[model samples]
Target: MVVRRCLVLLVATAAHVGCTYDFDAFMPSGAIDSDLVDDTSSGDAVADDAAAPLDSAIEDVIADANVEASDDVSVETSADTSADTAADTSADASADGSADTGGATDTGLVDTATPDVPVSCPDPEGKALGTHCYFPLAADNWDKAKAGCEARGAHLVTITSAAEEIHVESIRTGKDRWLGLRRPAGSPIGEGSFAWITTESVTFKKWGGGQPSGAGECAVLRAGNDWADLGCKSPRDPICERD
Candidate 1:
């Protein structure tokens, strides 16, 4: 009866407290009971059932953490990719700009349209002679010849030395040519009264024999390579000179 009452008390306590115990494992071998052993097995089954939900909760937390980590990594990768693309674009633009600048520099350094020509003679057809240019004009009167020479920025040829006289005489076409020498009206038939039309001082003279018989005011270089006075209206080819 006492053992039966103790058993009844143990069942009452277990129902009231909602707790479990390993009754058979703690009991002495002489006091072991089969019903209590069955209760101990049931308690172990409840403990395992309670632990299963905790394990599932822990697994759920781990899975959520893994998902968040994956999202962070994806964000970082996307940001890095964008930065790399921007950097590459900037670099490419810089390279293109540098290439364009270099091309412009190379093109600007060279010019290819103009050429070189001689600088001594202003008239392209004039002959360059001993530091001057000489050109022969068509037959014209003295005043007209002087005007023509002035129009072309030149003057009638003036011979100042025997060497120049010889040089010009060699190039003459054997035609009577007008000289720049002229005599002022009412002046004597001497060299002192003559002046070069170009205003150059008369430093030399090679008059032909018995010349300046006071024919006129203008002078001429005769075909025989000597100078003589003549009428200003006489037609003769003009020799033009310029430095």
Candidate 2:
């Protein structure tokens, strides 16, 4: 006759766990030809040996379960790391692409920090280019000229395109005029790194050959054609612009 039995072993992780083990035993029945009482002990010993294998199998199952749990944890950790990396990448992309990608020039930069003002030209006498209008006035130093433009709800022009440059040249009746471009103070004034205060980008530039030779701190449209670096205090009429 044979009998089968199942045993269960419970394991625990920091979180949770369980496992199952089965043991089978064979027993002999009916009278034997040689009935040796001493042999009975041998039979019992053989049963113990068989049970040893069952114990070993249970241990093996538990070890395998532990390894599987550890592997699951490791996989989850790796997945979390990947998700974090992806999120960081998305944030960076949004930071850089938001401006140029969206039609709001410098939407990702300085312009975004300020209010989104709708550009409107109440006076049509001044030439309109892009989103702003330009007005040519008499001569004055860079600071005074900027102030004057401000008095009229405008600022010095910031040229960012070739078309705008051409328009300025076409209508410029007098000498060169001051533009809003400026070099960093305490830094080389005219070596050509400039920014547009009204907007966040320099879309166009036309500097004269050897002009700005690191000469002065302010920028001007010379002959309304090309740009040159000049002293900030130099007397020159500004091409006022407003949106």
Candidate 3:
């Protein structure tokens, strides 16, 4: 029994040297042994110290994320406000332009007058010349040509200006054409004394050389684009004029 007790004490001493309490647990319940308690406070302190840096890093990440989110929201709000302002400005400008156009229309500044539509020549064969229509007729005497022109609701062509004479010259055939000029009773044998069949005033004349010569009553448009008196019975093509 003595040897066994000595061996058990040797084992407990060895176990205490190894920093274990397995052998100390067999002591009396009321006995206080300082080395019997496992001192884990130092390990827990090390763990807490290690976790602080990670926690701080996590807090910094969260703060940065919150700041970035705030910036994004602010940018989006500013962009939306700018877009709304531009839209309003565009709408206002369009409204002003429309109002201006309406005001112009109301003030009669817009030319709403129907544009003058030109009247077409009455006869399909009639050629439009200047402001009138001209029809070159077949060979006929002055009286017959006058009658033909009246039948067609027209008058024998009259030259009222040099421009009109140029216009008539453009359509001159190879032969002379009868004009509407004739001498009236009590009239002299001069260019001024002759009158158009339409009774228009004798405002212009192109008598050839020194002629009226009282050669005949009626006049003819020579191929050289001048006028000469001729007999009323002579056969010549006539040019008819109308609006």
Candidate 4:
């Protein structure tokens, strides 16, 4: 009985050994599970990191777009301001130019139309004759007397007719004054009608009473105030009339 019991015990022990689980294989399985879990975690972390970088890039693009818009607005505003300034400057210059031109024209017009006034003659050396104001030249040859009067811007007194000559003779002042009358030597007596050399006509005349009849063809005024037909070369004071 004891031997049989020993044999059974041995067989049972061997079978147990043969049916026992393989520890090495179990360990390898557990290790495989751990590696899978680690790999999955690492992949998840990498995905998260890539997503963050993409978001950052999107944000940078947005910021750049905003900066460009601001710069464009500033440029447009500056251009507008400059244009307004230029327009104002042009208007002001035009106004100033017009005003200056008008002023210049007015000045030019005013300068061209003013008239000159006449001057008055000085007095005392010569006496005034008639209401018309005549001056007498001092005694000189007839031609010289005439030239003297002309130099003073006057002409020898002109006598129109015999009646005017008579009238001039009435104002005698007791001196042999020159008359416009002149008789060339050897000229006929009555044939020479009295006339003024300046006017070349018998417009005014004055003769002393019965004066220019015959031998008195050559004549002189009795006073500085009278008129008579006289010799051409006779030296005497002459009267000058201002026009």
Candidate 5:
């Protein structure tokens, strides 16, 4: 019994030593596995950090390309606009040139159609008619004077100014000449307010002394600047006319 008890005690001690060694081995293995897991996680974090910069660089490159492309499009659009403006300017210039040419042609046609009329004048001494000058006709009635002047394509001289009256008087013959003087019938002046027979306004007036008496509306200018009021039907010398 003593020998059996000693052997049992020795076996129990050996078994306890074996259990402690196994526990120690298992603890070291678990620590190594945990360290390995932590190292792998740290490596993965570093790799992710390294790839972040690359992603940012790629994004920057893409952004630069997009900006460059947009700039290129803007430049192209500006060039096209410039070209269109130049074309429009050219068209306007062409239209202006065509208008100028057309205007020149029209002026040339107008110049060709209407010829200039020439002016002719006789001696400066006599009164100038339309285009001719003439002396006084023979003494005759007012009607006869009108007829005479009409025949020569002229009318009796209408005296406007004293200077013109003097001029006519200087050119008259010895006989009295009827002038273009008339007044409205039954007027307040009783024919004293005389006007030119041509119906033109009297811008000037010269009456002889002691002439244009009451009821003496009709009048005539003779040589020596002599003016006499007479009836419309009175016979007298008529001045020739010209044009």
Candidate 6:
């Protein structure tokens, strides 16, 4: 017993009909209503579900990008720091080299190689006389005696004055000693042609009569405290002197 609405039409003229209708009578059971269209909660729910996943995915992508950027920044920062540290080390090495150069320059202050000597001479003889010192010792020959005296920082005695001759004679302990008067084998006559092996000549002579032959001979102290010529190969004591 359902209630219903209907539309009925009666013909009043041959070409027209009067009509009455109830539009609600055509509605089906459970049909959609305009109020139901306004109620869109299920569509809102579906839209929210889709949007939530999309926002979550976008946030995850942003987080991954941030992580990659952070790693890149960290790597770049490490490279920059390593470069700075290497630069500092190079600067330190340069400073050390400069300091070494400074030290080398400072080392020049203490390079003394030679020292000064005194004017006085060293001799175990009695005393120094006339800017010279004398030493008396045994020697082999003219050359060997000269070598020995040179080893003592001296030369064979060269007597230029009578007092020097007497001083040399006074020191003679044994046999005759060699003097520094000498000349080449083939030489000119006169004392001017001879050279004193130990001193500069000032033209003084104390020869014994016809002594000091100018024929390739060396001089020696004779018995009379006078000079005499002798062969150079003969061994004799030497009176060494320093001037």
Every candidate's CA RMSD: 13.5, 19.5, 17.1, 22.8, 17.8, 19.1
User: Candidate 6: where is the Cα deviation over 4 Å?
Assistant: 1-126, 189-192, 214-216
Tens digits of per-residue lDDT for model 1, 12-98: 455444666565575566585566556655644545555566567768999999999999999999999999999999999878877
Model 4 lDDT per residue over 70-152, tens place: 99999999999999999999998878877879634344444566574443435334434343335666857787887887788
TM-score-better candidate, 1 vs 5: 5
lDDT (0-100) at residue 204 of candidate 2?
Answer: 74
Give the distance in Å from residue 239's predicted Cα in candidate 4 to where it truly belongs. 1.2
Q: lDDT: which is higher, 3 or 5?
A: 3
* TM-scores, one per candidate: 0.49, 0.47, 0.53, 0.39, 0.51, 0.46
- Clash tally, candidates in order: 0, 2, 0, 18, 7, 0
After the best TM-score superposition of candidate 2, give how far the Cα of residue 90 lies from its true spot, in angstroms: 52
Whole-model lDDT, model 1: 0.78
Q: 1-243 in candidate 6: lDDT tens per residue? A: 022101111111111222433334554654535544454345345444545655677789999999999999999999999999999999998788779896344445766786645446545554467667887877788999999989987888888887887788888765688888888776765556567975586477887776556534787887677777788898788888877
Best candidate, TM-score: 3
The global C-alpha lDDT for each of the candidates, from Candidate 1 onward, is 0.78, 0.69, 0.74, 0.59, 0.64, 0.70
List runs of model 2 lying over 4 Å from the truth: 1-125, 189-192
Over 16-40, each residue of candidate 2 has an lDDT whose tens digit, in order, gives: 2223222123225432223333444
Residue 190 error, candidate 6, Å: 4.8
Predicted candidate 2, C-alpha RMSD:
19.5
- Which pairs of residues have clashing backbones in candidate 5? 131-243, 132-243, 137-240, 139-237, 140-236, 140-237, 191-217
Which of the two, 4 or 6, has more lDDT? 6
- Worst 10-residue lDDT window for candidate 6 reads 5-14
Mind giving the per-residue lDDT tens digits that candidate 5 earns over 1-243? Answer: 443333233334434344323433534544434444455445435445555665677689999999999999999999999999999999998788779897343444434576535434343334554344656676467877887877767788777667666667767766667887877777765333778778878787665666676445567775656777777677776765464
